[model samples]
Target: MAATITNTVIDLSHHNTKPDFAKAAADGLQGVIHKATQGQSGVDPTYAPRRPKAEAAGLLWGAYHFGTGSDGVKQAEHFLKTVGPDHASMLLVLDLEGNPTGPSMTLEEARAFVTHVRAVTGRWPGLYSGHYVKELLHAQKDPVLGQCWFWLAQYGPTPVVPPAWAKWTFWQYTDGAIGPGPHEVPGIGACDRDKFNGDAAKLTTFWKAGGV
Candidate 1:
């Protein structure tokens, strides 16, 4: 069956302060995905501590790695080492964005990074990228990478899933401040808001299934 898309979620990093995950959950967020590592060496300082807070809030917590397009295997190794094997019940995302100071990654490089992470974690890492990057990856027609789930990033009223994806598992719809009235998020100011492709129960199932 095609997944039902409705619930809201949020992705945060060290750029934002320690959030009140309980308040966020009360405010209608179903899950939280945090930036755990960047490149092959950079680690988010808040991830280790904040992750537990998110979990305690009864939110499905996940982690992502910002790709540098360098050595995919080593980068995956770094991410695995940092997040550890305990994340079997949560999502694993590969954040593929344009690096302002680095060269763009070829499809092979991207696939290698994702595949290596999957091999180590035994969970398929969801691909998170904007439209252009998604299109580029789609053109490669990679069996391994193309089979993974997608988290499409677009800032508008409606999110457009890339043609390569059968369906988008997550959609980041707003990077601006959003909430009831002008309050932005309860604890996080000017955050990226997202929509899970399913409801709360399905999200819990997805998390337990390791994102399939």
Candidate 2:
């Protein structure tokens, strides 16, 4: 059987703050859709390998903003400028987790930002958050998000994606991962590995089509 593209996302955020990044990425899986923060300074050194490795493996590569309360368009521009245009991410994720805690946005405002990201990037931008954020969006009522896909991070053994949210292309099932890295970070333990539903090509199209 051909190898399945059970894509993982590596975040550069401190493991405690964002525990899934290293564990998921270094799982030595087919493709990875890692994220990097923008608008402050430069790209993250840890997440640096995510894009190159994906490209090298002919695997799906994607990136997203940490959603630092910046306007979606500005964030998109910052990502493009930093990562360069050649690195075409299958999907651009707007991590909608931490924003609402501070001088961030409400669910309604966050949705608008997501739309703006899609408009500016010319690709489907996805939403990355836990169950609460999904609930906040009331994903059922406001379903059609152009071509965007959802990169759900509701950690568990089963696929906890809300049915009303439609098919989720990427499901992060666990935080236990182990591997080498761009920095000397501890791995997240062992990964479950059987959860991915799509292949690389599917992932690519899914990403380009906004993860729909």
Candidate 3:
């Protein structure tokens, strides 16, 4: 069987928007995908346009929250509310770029926050952030998210997985795309065939098991 290439969140800001890009690239895809947020806590009006394009091309969809000045948990709550969690393929994502406004929380606190949100939502929200951030947490072996599948954002040839993070289900490789919009992970072409790791049945089973 061919390995599935499922890069969950594609942030279509200044980068991915072009003439007929989203509408074009929606062909030959599988599993749930998300539109990444940009500017002032992820409330861009472009989501409406991007989503229909993907849906037209046959892709299950959702939205991802790029974190800002607020606490991680609070940011997550806002994202969940903003996107709502009952779509065809609903998966909330927490994008942790850095602590620009508020004081950075300790590793313990960050992990705890992730765990708390997962418990509350009953879904395994994804983590999208830099390699350095993962490395910092790796040193401490963050207990809160040892098993979470990472959507790593590294614009390069090969993705470097932090030792602490063992499994990497998705890797966002670049801000460029070939035929259409900016691909969430450009190097996904490096993989054979693309599909989500778990089908709806598997996702539902995981949810019931409280694995998120």
Point out where model 3 deviates above 4 Å. Answer: 1-10, 18-26, 31-42, 99-113, 177-212
* Residue 148's lDDT in candidate 1: 77
Candidate no. 1 TM-score: 0.89
- Which of candidates 1 and 2 is the stronger one according to TM-score? 1
Which of 2 and 3 is the better model by lDDT?
2
The lDDT-based order of candidates, best leading, equals: 1, 2, 3
Q: What value does the lDDT take at residue 102 in candidate 2? A: 49
In order of appearance, the predictions have TM-scores of 0.89, 0.65, 0.65
Shift in Å, residue 171, candidate 1:
0.2
Q: Candidate 3 lDDT, tens digit per residue, 4-90?
A: 444333444433434243433444333334444432365656665666665665554555665554455665555555565454345
Query: What overall lDDT goes with each candidate model?
Result: 0.79, 0.53, 0.51
Candidate 3 lDDT at 91 equals 50
Cα shift from native, residue 104, model 2 (Å): 4.2
* Candidate 2 lDDT tens digits, 94-174: 666665444553455556656666565565577666675656655454554423556667555455665545666566655
Looking at model 3, residue 16 earns an lDDT score of: 40
> Candidate 1 lDDT, tens digit per residue, 1-212?
86577656788999888688888778877778899998889899999999888889888888999888688888889988999878778888888888777765556777888899777877679999886576675554558777779998877666666666777788887775442222256766568877787777887788778898
Q: Report the number of the highest-TM-score candidate.
A: 1
